[model samples]
Target: MNSFPVTKFYDSGKVHTTDTYYELLQLIDTKNIAFEVPKMGQKLPFDSVLGVQVLNVDSKASDNNDASIVLKAKYGKVSFLLTGDADVAIENTMLPKYDLKSTYLKAGHHGSNTSSSSNFINEVYPMGTVLSYGKDNSYGHPHKEVVSRLTTVKSKIYSTAVSGDVTVTTNGQAHSVSAKAWTPPTTTPTPPSAGTTGKLQVVKKDLSTEIVSIQNVGTTDVAMAGWKLVSVQGNQSFTFPTYTLKAGANVHVTSGPNAKSGGNYLKWTTANIWLNSGDPAKLYDSKGALIHEVK
Candidate 1:
């Protein structure tokens, strides 16, 4: 199945330095891998990264959500946030969710001024940040102000243009980093606004076959009791005798089946709209409930 990777990058609260769609295609060509690129608002495949669930590729972009992708791959909490050339407004809203002191961040938008806010730097507290760019390329990558911000926070920095393929390896407990042509710079960037909202968990999971989990993203608190589960086979609907949850509430449903064997599929729905199922499942809010089944 073809998948879209941009939605994930955008939702994670970082700017896109290059056309990621084009880059993925290039990767496929260079590596001779068979892959398909889906339309916007799609979800990528999910796998266990360092013991945590990670869907590296997916499309979940929409009018209500920003363009970013957040990866929680265990290895000591490293986030590769792509903002797609967004300005300071976007960065300010995103820096607070993760641990700045320990997290590893990917510099936003080729090091543009529109990004890299002071408030963002304080929250990311990244152990080391990477700037992906080309040597002496056009956009004047590694912007001076952006660099200054890093220095202010005393964050170890690396540049892809100089370092070649910057790679960060983590074991969910500790991290080991190495880069080619990477050189530490001594400059920083001007600070920008602290975004509206800090960070949020977009995807959630559980064992209940009927209802996996609940997700509420908007400012208003949406109820979950009204939502029902739809089976993947025959598109059947299983009504919830009694289930009520407000927005930002993570409720787990113990009234569903476990999707252990193949051929069994289901989704959560509210009225005619589907909340957790199919592609949108990746963006489940779940408030914070543990949705699973019992033996």
Candidate 2:
């Protein structure tokens, strides 16, 4: 006896097979197998313990649209939407057809611009949005516009690129998100000294542009060569490039475009080096000694 893998298609008359399908057919002894065509508004008969619903499944839509499946799982009042690579078209079609509000949402198309429309996101109003994409992916998953839209909705966004293997636990009334792999940075911070360590203080921090200004408040000039500014959350560091800070002078370090080494500005070159919710900025000397830190 030979075993055959059974699959389902939307249209029974239009079923087609590929080369791999033909190879599998040859290995199976069964001459004919039936495929099930799920109805448009069909709901899976799962046990009452797990509340899962299939909201929409339109096979007449285009190839990408046809393959899309919008599913919502409910545990009492808490709900989750697990959308697989569904584009904006699929989302728009489902918006008015179903109740999309959920506690958690897996961002469509891995946060691609083709999906996660502002209208769709607003309709869902998820508390947390998770972008399931690889780190440094070639296609640049989680596009900035999508992220901005999610941010506008005040959604806590988590990306596999930054925090790996995120886990969410809920008891129907409340939910908490955590990543076991991510750990907060622990450092023995040094307090600001008046004149000994050059009195470096973080005068201002612009979270939007990741720009941090460190001022020398001491009476003597501070040799800034080999000094570093580090973010405690991400451990992102910016090293001074052979410059000297005179007394009462401030140097700006930006983590984005417009990097210049002139009168008072330096650039970190990397994007999003600082946490928006405020992280500790520690300044270290050339010998890896912590000189000053600002929270």
Candidate 3:
């Protein structure tokens, strides 16, 4: 038998499921698996392969639905927020803890009214949301209010009930989503990895636009939290928040009277921080270590 990666559980005692615990325990014992109970903000060691952030897991969850594990994973330019039946109360706790913004969201609780709160939807700001549910199920999933909320956020919606399967594809720079009924998979299959591992560099600087572009040239996504870009001439710096720059993807740090964040842009400052003539930019990692410098 092939060994698997260490299993990380929120809490062993709190693990609840519809399936019998004895069966699960038997499997675990047979495998002799090693596991861990990670903390709330702990990032799994699987970062080498893909960026994974454990956004939420409550040992004291009031019910099984609330106890679900919520995670946000990023590979290349696409990010996925997978909420496992977590409800509104769980969403409330996760709001202030992490940057929920993502490219795609697997709507929690089958898009039920119990989850996908207005604040949560606004925070995640998903580009596309997939609601996995049954067609004409007894209990109506993807409630009217939830649909309205996602609509207000302007996220493209996909449903399993309508389409047999949904497929999303992306390069580090561009992405597309499509759906089709599932055949026997006689043909279609799914897809990034190729050079250097964690190399990040400041690729471009536009003085007039107050834009400094930072890109991950390597094949692996890099965690850029606490990384900051400094204006050498102005002596001002913009510190990055919790974020992951996917392999070959870039994030623009903008600073000016009208600086703002939308899509791949990150607002550095409202006041001008770059000179019109020219200015050098320096990038630093979380440890205040210099990563790249651009003139």
Candidate 4:
């Protein structure tokens, strides 16, 4: 665990917290994680807090979302501002209270117009802004006005609804984006060419063991590199490493706690994925064509 304190800056005064919050606090207590309450202008220890610095926390008390903890984090020269559902009222309260400029901004309240006010946008002038809202959500977040405001300032915008998730890698000063956009397969899986072994089968999938075994039933070798194994129910995928399956050979893709990687055993992850009730698995080739599926 990184030696950073998980700070809590808000608590209900007149409106008490829900039972869910009590349960969450209990879970945090069970984990032995250090939780703290912070004050303004207190910077966390630079060495142990994952290079993040604390700028300000709302000094006044509130019973609504405005009580959310707002923070700034930096790695080398790159900086980020994260506003947790804090609305425009909180933004205005913080404007003159702290140094709010940032390289990237996770727009408040999922880019709703209630937050990201023109005054605040003009103050930060972030290089890139992210709007995080579900696709076809009921509220229709990322309101057009907010997008227009960011555009007016020429800040590059990214949305999780458009791109499933956008990844950012920065060397402190410079940054790059890798979009994890999903697209459907255009054509069905086709048969292998003549004299080439094109057949494979998911012979077994055991939730108890968290392993999916695939056998090459064909007479030719099948390249497994770039292949993907997907959990249909969970909607999670794992890409295979560089390897090839010879004729009549089999490989086991394992997940969960007992997973181990080797020549014939490939570890997909260390977390439990297979459903206890029931789940299906799908195999896709490098060309995005379906190879096989098993329950």
TM-scores, all candidates, are 0.42, 0.50, 0.54, 0.53
Candidate 3 off by > 4 Å: 1-13, 17-19, 47-49, 180-295
Which model, 2 or 3, shows the larger lDDT?
Answer: 3
In model 3, which range of ten residues has the least summed lDDT?
A: 188-197
lDDT of 2 by residue, 41-92 (tens): 5665556655777765655543433356667888878899988767787788
Candidate 4: give the clashing pairs: none
Better of 1 and 3 by lDDT: 3
List, residue by residue over 1-295, the lDDT tens digit for candidate 1.
Answer: 1454332222332223224435655665665665443333233454445323222223443311234333333333455443444445545544443333336667666676556777777776676787776676423567678888888887778887776777777656566678743444435433222222212232344322334444444355443332334332112333332233344655443332232211222323322222232323322112323232121
lDDT of 4: 0.72
| Whole-model alpha-carbon lDDT for candidate 3 | 0.74
TM-score of 3: 0.54
Q: What local distance difference test score does each model get?
A: 0.45, 0.70, 0.74, 0.72
CA error at residue 115 for candidate 4, angstroms: 0.4
The TM-score that candidate 2 achieves is: 0.50
Task: Tell me how far candidate 3 lies from the true structure as C-alpha RMSD in angstroms.
Answer: 22.8
Worst 10 residues of 4 by lDDT: 9-18
Q: What is the descending lDDT order?
A: 3, 4, 2, 1
Global lDDT of model 1: 0.45
